[model samples]
Target chain A: MTSTNHTLFEDYLRGYISDEEKKRLELVLDSSETEREEFDLYKTMRRTLSPNIGNPYKERELKEHLEELGKKYTHEFSNEVMEMPVVRKAGYVRRILSVAASFTLVGLIGIAAMIPKNTSKALAQAYVYSSDSTAPSRSVNGDNLITSSEEYYLSGMQAFKEHKYETAIISTRKAKVGASPELIQEIEWLMALSELGLGNDAKAKELLTEISTDTKSDFSGEAKELLEDLNGIMHRISSFF
Target chain B: MPTAKTYLNGIKQTSHKVQHPDQKYIEALRTNDMILVEDIYKNYGQMITDLVKKNNGNAQDAMDLFQEVLIILHRYSQEGFTLTCSLKSFLYTLCKRRWINELKKKGRAETLKVADISDLNFAEESKESVEGTEMYDQRFRFCKEKFNLLSPGCKEIIQLSWRKQEDGKYCSWKEIAEELDMSYAYIRKKASQCKARLIELARKDPGFKNL
Candidate 1:
């Protein structure tokens, strides 16, 4: 009911309380249902939010790794679907649908061209890539021999700045191997930006989705903003059809 | 009735010990073993994609669902959870249940086309595991959401209070006090007050009962 009681509860939970204080606190908790319930909730919160010391970055690392796996497997699945057999009798029907689809695709493209170009692309272009706060800084002209990770990361950022998105993507992907958690987060952000600059919306969206979902990532806010823009464009396009 | 301490301790116990053959997958998730995790995706990824797509979802939705389910798996594995069924069955069951829940939330439940889960041999165990994990995940998420609603000062002190140092030991109040430029007594009291506020917020939520 009071801050003092909560402090006592905390002391007791952390085993910092003396025997007398612990007994008093237990008595108070036992006598009052409201206090007991509060203790339960507080205890649960402490347990739930306790940091994973063994691998503090497990979720972030796993998410990034799984994003790559998802991309690969999804691509394979799509190819498998394409290679699947179709009935010979439906060839004419398929041809007719193909013709209609072609016209629809052209019509959609024309409409897309007439509208203001996708705002997502504009937003992605305008997104300023900030360096990760946790990542260690290295001078480009440092006398020390650069490690592979550093080399790739530096080149990736260089390519990104030069507007060579394909090169940026390639360099960052190489940089991701054996990188620190901070560097991995930065590399993924860079890769997402490269994908966006190259107008590869699906890959950009996939990369952004992974980054945005991580609340602790440095680029999460920017990723979320870009994702919202991308989703808005997608919704508008889908609704038009 | 058991006291809160006993109840909390019970949850912390290694409740299940009969490890299934699929326990390796849980370990892979917990340890962030990228190669094993990729193997998990290679083996079960298509199955999940098919499950989601069959239920009116797209590739992106399927990907999102897969990542989410993996997160749940990771959490349970961290808590010393033992697999009583095959990982595939457990994952498939969780995904299937979660997809349905998503559809229900979106008011598109009627459009859900159920996948054939008849071949999943450990149906009851899988269902029970899914339910338990869902409840645990929901409760944690609810409390975390409430924790985020506290004042900035409250959140910071509470976070820094139990934060681990390089040696993997929790920071003492004195250390936290120095870090925050406050007295030890003040830091401890602030963290306690903040924690109390967080718990109170959770208790006051309309969905507290559900959690």
Candidate 2:
């Protein structure tokens, strides 16, 4: 190729070529197989050199997110399996069942009560507050004993309040093995709520299923109600198709 | 087979079909839907863990491989890749293949068993998709390595000219030249020369020829 053609190719690769120049270059490339091959090679080189060129910020964000996920999975899998006791508080049972019944009614009525006019705007409203129910405090014994799992659980709760749902779930999962049976319910519930906030219906459903099946837990009724609501939503979404 | 006219008319008449199931999973990754991510782990975690353990690897190794596979999928989707199979199958195959490679790298190839993969039917399209991603990753590494070897000035010029702005525009040669306090014409020539040097270096690599 001529020096002029080579310059045009470089200019084209760098996106500096004007429409007219591009047309001329296209003609040159069409006229010779060698020029076309050269064009292809330069195109490949440009693509290879800049894989994340368009969204470096997004790429960096994704890398950070991946690192966080790695830490979460490592912590979750590395913990020793502990035999959990099925401890239930009689005082909380009635309140929990009442809350569950209310939620079940909401689910049966198309979730209109729980869901606001704007679904995205309703995420913050869905935060599961400890004060929402008169249920006995599992984490608030007189001694106020704290374990590493409880610390992680509290941190996870803080993260949830900050709308960092992924961090909340990770931290809560890290608390799983160390938490007492009573605290386990709260941790699982919060983790499920975080999942719901993040649009992970399937995951949220799975957690809720586990919670509902553990009838001994204070959150069992509430979990069953939430699972029904999730099912309702899924059914509605699928039917929209 | 339908005739060309029939196909064209049908295309005009019909609305788009339901999205593939895997598309939802892809969207979950893109949007950072942690719930979906957790569900993915719940569904496939044990299978992958077992595979890794049985193949002379551990849970940590499995997690790493799983995360890497997800990253690859995310990257591929960002580059306009579409999945043709169920997410479960695709993920399983990708993780299994990666774990096998990892084992082989650790000189445990003799212990690698094919029984796990025997029942997993990987579609031709999926195989091509994974291979294409692998090739792109290789080329990207090779190019990055060669580009880093260039002079500082060359690197700056090339990066400035090629780097995309937040608004999706490339910085013009004039802008780059002004930023660097160099003449536009001189900067243009320098960029071309730098590019030529990079191409020469890349060409010298044996893998580049194969690519």
The lDDT of model 2 is 0.64
Candidate 2: residue pairs that collide: none
Tell me the deviation in Å of residue B166 in model 2: 2.2
In terms of lDDT, the poorest run of 10 residues in model 1 chain B is: B114-123
Docking class of 2: incorrect
Q: Give candidate 1's root-mean-square deviation (CA, Å).
A: 13.4
lDDT for each residue of candidate 1 in A7-45, tens digit (9 for 90 to 100): 676667667779898777777777788888777766667
Clashing pairs in 1: none
How would you encode candidate 2's per-residue C-alpha lDDT over A12-68 as one tens digit per residue? Answer: 655677989777777666666666655566666665555454345665666677667
Cα deviation of B186 in candidate 1 (Å)? 1.3
